[model samples]
Target: MVHHTMTTNSTSASRASSRISSMSRFLVLAAIVGMLAACGSVPLPPMEVAPPRPAAAAGTPTAPDDGAPLPGPIVQGRSRWQPVRWSELPGFDTDETYEAWNAWLKSCERAPAPFAALCPEVRRLSLASPQEQRAWMMQRLQPYRVEPLNGPAEGLLTGYYEPMLEASRRPTASQNVPLYRPPATLGSRRPWYTRQEIDTLPEARAALRGREIAYVADPLDALVLQIQGSGRVRIAEPDGSVRTVRLAFAGSNDQPYRSVGGWLLQQGLLRDASWPGIKAWAVQNPQRVNEMLWSNPRTVFFREEPLSEFDASFGPRGAQGVPLTPGRSIAVDKDSIPYGTPVWLVSQGPVTSLQRLVLAQDTGSAITGAVRADYFAGWGPEAGELAGRLKQPLRLWVLWPK
Candidate 1:
């Protein structure tokens, strides 16, 4: 009787485990389906499928070679362009040096006028051999060093697989696979000093002032990191501009989707303000709020300029059949790709025809090197669409400059 009872208990436990596993699988599938539905309906472009290899050919050895070296510095217009190999670049990738420099700067009694004040010292030290730089950096930072692992306890790290969905193709059984494992913990690792605290330190101030300055900017361009609050989104720009865009929520309590923007417009929200009256109307009609929000066409916008009289040989036409802002449109440096270089980009994977003539009108903090660029799709709906669709590898060439 005891043996029989133990067998029944074991069987019951196995069945319970099986049921739980089944439920987890179902939840994952549901999440995938919901994500696909949220993306809405847009016909995918033709895929450039790679040719299949035979089983015997798969094992064939290829020639041993390093990747293409950085192309030699090319000159265009007034500026000289040198290829910036990030891994090979001096003063970058030296975590200890940066940490030391940062710590020393913080220890100072006054805020260095600008962040670049320490750059020259950094450059001088970096000119030494890598080992020398490491030693020097460690020595400088040692005075300010804190225990690396000392911090407040946080939550446990978890691991799980997430399903992958292709924007250009329908979901297949193969695409659903586990993929993510987060770190074990992210504790309260604080900066050594706050800005205000750093500004007050005399030694820190003097050290920074003595150091070399590299790059400093006013009105920096900030990237949009995340949406915060109900009506604001954060922006980071190249000019060092960091701020939040406040949005105007126009929808009624019944319908939350009817929103317009100062954020939306600047970030390319509405094509135009055709529905100025819609917000007030939305507030009154709670029952029809969702319908009202859904009915209006969402639009995106970019600042418009008359296309140049330059011939169609330049590129695509504007609404009135004239050349669009030829050089002013997005472009990369030719030395980098000169200001007006037109690029044809081919994307990787299923989404095809991700074509645009992006003029490199602006630069980014991390956007250096011959291959780097910033593509500006027109603002509002157009920009949002392009940004959302731009998840694949890009191959670009300066068609006109070359």
Candidate 2:
């Protein structure tokens, strides 16, 4: 829930990977959201809340009592990029290069400018030692600190994950809730039907009669899959065959993404904005779960993707058009850290902590500002738990081509 405090409610990074329903900004909020509006949190300031600022920016290269010397801000795409010494990046030497290299290999598949040329060598060096990898990096890259436009040098770091659920090919007595594919005429419509209509309207239900890819028992799990915009469902097919498949973002109803957690907070139904709290509310008012869901008018549609043995191990494609590397792939504001760029990230918070090498392999609408990022935590329940709880102060350095 803490990480979700700074997340986006619209089309998520995975949606950003595809067309998703929406593309917007993430806020430094106190929200606990899930995929597409399903169960993950978005990044935004709470309604009417403003971002906090640093203590002060001392102009000189003053050696502070604690960490590295913070630099003054310089202009960038709606933010600031300040020159900093590589020595200032904490734990750079300690981070393993193997994980980041694998993530980079995936980035090379789409190959953003200037990075493609380095891929051949990157591959050649894949089997090299970490020390050698570090040497190559230092020889080829320069570091720059990122900050908010005209603001301080710090920002928030949060995580997002793929929530896993169980499903059945055909609806059963308990698994009646359907995850539908987009209507064939979805593109022809602008603002499509709302969540309420999809749930209660006969016409809307009829519009999706034969389009269900899989059916699950829990509405919360379904919603989490929607909000995250990507998920893995362990399905029991009609032949009694059981296997896992990915439900990707096919389209959306074009309705505005509203925060269900925030709504519950306003109604005084819960104190903590988290999946646990929301589930508790649902348990107490079992009959009104649909009511809570309808509070969010937006609806996400999915297209089922058959999973390969290898694909099952990786994540769904992200905004950068590459599979996400758990703990290594981060969703950024393309305006600041362009897709395919390497980033050195550091953050310490209540729910999560990290100091590592990562790649800008995805984007999110709410992932704006110079230093913000949404760490893709990978799939399933453990990942979702981490994503929901991870909210911390972040510091980033773009490892640019020298």
Find the candidate with the highest TM-score and give its number. 2
Q: Model 1 — TM-score against the truth?
A: 0.23
Model 1, global lDDT: 0.24
Judging by lDDT against the true structure, name the best candidate.
2
Regions more than 4 Å wrong, model 2:
1-75
Give residue 94's lDDT in candidate 1 (0 to 100): 29
lDDT of 1 by residue, 1-402 (tens): 000000011111100000000000012222111110011112223423323322222333322213545455444442333432222222222223332332222212122233234445555653344345433332232111001122221111000111111110112243221111111111222222222232356743443342211111110000010000011223333365644332111111111111222222333433332223223333465565434323312211111112233321232221112222322233232244443232333333342333332333323222234443323232233333332232233434332210
- Candidate 2 lDDT at 185 equals 65
Q: Could you tally the backbone clashes for each prediction?
A: 48, 37
What's model 2's overall lDDT? 0.69
